[model samples]
Target: MRTGFRSVTAVVPIALAALAYAIVVPVTPARATPLPSRSAPQQRHVREVGDTAITTMDGVYTLAQATRGGNVFAAYCKSCHTPTFHSGPPFRAKWYGRSLVDLFVYVRREMPKNAPGSMSDADYTLAIAYLLRINGMPTGAKPLAADTAELRRIRLDSVPAASSPEGPAR
Candidate 1:
């Protein structure tokens, strides 16, 4: 019994020491590297109002393109969803301030419900143009490009403020 007690006493201290060492040995301070600087041209910033590249001010798409898109919407989209649903207040509320590219990508990938992603990129682009036009966004002289990168830069918030008699324009 004394031998057994001795062994347990000796083992417990050694086991605890091993555990303490195991817990304490692995911790080390971390060093982080600073990020490299970018050139002025490489760092593009979007400004409110004046910056055409970021804001959808003068309209991103052309009226001609929108007209063609209207045709596409009538043929492929009108059956399941109405233009009002796409361009109405509810739709604007959800989509405003987001990138037009997001809308384009969604429509291209998941539109036509029964036959999603079936439409060509051109068709999808036109459809978006039409929706923007109906939603009261301005129409630009140049058509909105089908390129995703360019589309990403343009925000979808070009809706005119609503007027209120009791307070300032909302």
Candidate 2:
């Protein structure tokens, strides 16, 4: 009985120590370390359209075109949808960080639900410009081309800094 009690006592202490260690080790915070920066070449990788790093200030489209698009949207799209609907939080949540071209294509292919692809390519591109404008993207001197390749190069990120009052300095 004496030997058994000693053995049990020894096992209990060991088990309690292990339990305490296991509990305390995981709860302890780990030391933080700074990550290494990427090389210039490594940082220059091809950026996708929806990348957060991309913005609309890269001269992707023109304000004049967006104005024309606004007219087009009023004529054809107003009956089915509202301008606010396309530029509101829901729209941002759905299209932010996507390809501008992808949105254009979808609009061209499946928009005006009653008659899809009914408008001319120029009109469609203009409509896209209007959408961008409404979403707070700044317009440039040049018009947005109807070409897919050109559009693909432009991304749909957050509103450009130029649009904000506290916009980035140049």
Candidate 3:
């Protein structure tokens, strides 16, 4: 008998037995662990600014941050996204009412598809700053902090209306 033929015959029975065992045996789903209790303080998405809420409408990030974000996007994110993907009405519609923290968490956890969360928190935050700039949000005197707690303060509402040369219309 040929060596290959003998090996095939020997393996077939073992494969068939394994298959039969799988079919015959009942598999139970793993028990789910209970979620942690909310003993931690709740995070607030809105930051009060006098009578108004501080949102993306106000300057939350800086031009320098946005510029660095552009480079980051070109290096890592451009393969999957066009500049247009981050701009205009569609992006705003999807992201509106979500806090910057939501964006930061999402990108940090699931971006770069092949290797998620590879970038530092600062890079992800800068990428968000770029998105904000392209969408026509104003820049602040301060750069947007990379910290999640700071990011949570800014709610991403609608893209603000275009302001006149002097300032936003009342």
Candidate 4:
């Protein structure tokens, strides 16, 4: 029932906080060292999030951070991108397997229906990996990267033609 904090109790917390800060704040020799900058070109160090892993030709990533990304997607994207509909076709009558790499690139480039490129690499990879999994691709030991070089290698399987459809393409 005491909505207002008594001055005595408030003073104790403030004093304790000040005492803790006083103890933690060092007033001795400043231990500051300048780290040497890399002379060579900067390389993007792949940071693994948590459990989401992607297998790419260049290397592998165990995206431990993808779990967060999955939740982010579900909260923002599940309404528009229904898992059942994200298949080999247009959820109705269209072939989506024409270009596997394009789809991957598009998703990586823009997705989540809210934030594009704002997501961490781990999130991006996990979203794509989950999409691929839904489309029938098997998950490998390693996680995928945002690299386009590896994605172009594997062809995506769209809706197979009802019959022959002129046998491959001309």
> What are the TM-scores, per candidate, against the unseen true structure?
0.63, 0.62, 0.64, 0.44
Candidate 1 per-residue lDDT, tens place, 48-163, comes to 42234454544567778778778778777888887657664766688877888899899988886755665666777888888777777667666777778667777776454342
How many clashes (backbone N, Cα, C below 3 Å) per candidate? 0, 1, 0, 12
- Give one digit per residue, the lDDT tens place, for model 3 in 95-151: 888878889999999986645766666677778888888777778667777777667
Model 1, residue 27: distance off in Å is 62
Candidate No. with top lDDT:
3
Most TM-score-accurate candidate: 3
Model 4, span 46-142: residue lDDT tens: 1222331112211222333234334545644586777656544452133232333566567656764444444444445556555554443433444
Model 2 residue 131 distance off true place after TM-score fit, in angstroms = 0.7
lDDT of each: 0.64, 0.64, 0.66, 0.42
lDDT of 4: 0.42
- Which scores better on TM-score, 1 or 4? 1
